[model samples]
Target: MNVKNVYIAYTNCITPLGFDVDSNVQAIANGVSGIRLQENSTLMTAPFYAGVIDSDKLNTAFAALSDAKATRLEKMMVLALDPIIKKSGVELNAKTALILSTTKGNITVLNENAVPVPDAYLHQLAQNIVDFFGFTTQPIVVSNACVSGIMAVSVAKRLVQAGLYDNVFVISGDEVSEFVLSGFNSFQAMSDVPCKPYSANRKGVTLGEAAAAALVTINNSEAKAKIAGDGSINDANHISGPSRTGEGLVRSIESAFNEAGVTAQNIDYISAHGTATPFNDEMEAVAFNRLGLNEVPVNSLKGYYGHTLGASGLLETVIGLESMARNKVFASMGYDEPGVSQPINVLAANLDTPVNCFLKTASGFGGCNTAVVFQKVNNGR
Candidate 1:
């Protein structure tokens, strides 16, 4: 692939922290948290907090479609995508490529039946989007667990670079359901309270439901950031666990750097996939220290976003670019004491820094991991 320029035209996200890109960036800048305790409920019966979007507001905004037979996951995807689609002025048609990413796509339907596998549930969700937009092109679904969003972006880049499509619509979403909650409960990975990433007293993860989308193109003159290079690699060590020494993550990072032709010191900020889990955080620390970037500002939006699963990688990368435009970086909230023995400088407060280039890393199940390097285009636009 001899692609030179890739642009993120616009990003729209619905998270517990903020509703849109501007508000989300503000929350990140102020070091605000979106996690709140969830009361007893049939779908989610845990004491941990979550970053949930305002359902009432969403319902009001989408009231016109109330008569339609749209699932909650589908509604959430449209809600996150409405703003960007409206601004892009790009009609949803065969000319547009739709790449949907999710870990558990509309699994709530399966929970209602309990007679089908996860894959069946996913195909149905893809059909919903294709029908919603009345598109003739086949919808491509990527389900590489937590790295799904970044993987979706990588695919979109390739398709555009290949001239398969001029505009790519990347939508990622996952909703809270009983099945996933029970699975995490079985793993004993649900936090009792709001998650505290990189903190010594951190408990576990608090799953969050969210959807976000970005319009990608080869010639987006209004992009907030440019996609310089992206790389993905599998560790093949464990399907559900990460490498202890962060070897896989290191490999992905090296590939991203080589693709971007940028060195370690060129990276000004890192949006880590700090899921607050014991193994994940420890592995991230090792990766950062090994890269000799222990001094650079490092933080995880998981503290605020509460780990949006499939939507997280794109959501965090969007925030990284927005923060660069704003000239400030968010601190890893709920982080006071270092949890790992590694000398990783977990940011304690928001800092004003010149961010020219940033890196986003994600590690997920199936030994899948990805690293994407983004640079701010200084074309004086």
Candidate 2:
């Protein structure tokens, strides 16, 4: 069997930090966070800090594309994807594909009392986006909780490798709505302030909303980072809580390393799924330590992006790729103290270091965890 190499090239992100990739990275480089206290009388009894996109700004930016009636989530999906799709020059054909990832797609529409509940279905969300862009192939949706982002990337890589498509546009997004806000509140997982992943004083997750898109193809010229390895596993431990033993996450990373033909020592950085939740943070610490990756500098973008749910893994991967190209590792924002049980190194400050290879990991509801290994490509050709 012939295997084709896959690379991620164009990336676009829509968040409160800014509309595009550069703006988002600039905010991170400056140690700024998009999370803030949001006030809504009905959403919650108290103000909760969350990373939310400004409706006015989103509308203003999206106006350039179309003014058709659409759900906010749908608009966001299209917004994050349009630029990259236009830049790819890949036509919508049998060899091209569109993949969407999200934990909740168009859920807000249902909250607004849309006539048809199926309007919130994941397939409907994909169809809406496909209709906007006129994609000819059948739409694929990956909705594996928080792992949806990186997992979608893995799916795309395999599809291209399987000769099912030559290129794919992968987009993942979710919104911070009353439903999501109340759901986290039910778990008592909403942090009072900004989230602090792996910090001794870390309380809980601060949910954010954003849409991130990337173009993956076999053409090395479109390559910004090479997808070297991927692994997905389920511990079946608990629905909301991760394995206390870190069994699944540990195995996932080990498999990724094995697939990449590299060891923990070869990875320069780790973009982890640090939700700041007690179990999740501790679980990651244990897993990294057990895998002999305790010394590898790791950072969770949750502090900057506020745990953007399904959008986080892929967003962090894109940022990790850029961090490698820039030769800088952004600080683990909101982390001032070591909190986890293990001696894993959590980045405290931005450092100028070469990052050739990095690990992107995420653990979500239903005991699902995913890890993907990416390496910088010379000349990005």
Per residue, candidate 2 scores C-alpha lDDT tens digits across 297-346 of 99999999898888888888888988888889999999999999898889
Return the TM-score for candidate 1, rounded to 2 decimals.
Answer: 0.94
Worst 10 residues of 2 by lDDT: 107-116
Task: Please give the lDDT score at residue 341 for candidate 2.
Answer: 89
Task: Work out the TM-score per prediction.
Answer: 0.94, 0.98
Can you write out model 1's per-residue Cα lDDT over 20-69, one digit (the tens) per residue?
Answer: 88888877777777787766487665454777776777676567644566
The positional error of residue 55 in candidate 1, measured at the CA in angstroms, is 2.7
Tell me the deviation in Å of residue 311 in model 2: 0.9
**Prediction RMSDs, each to the true structure:** 2.0, 1.1
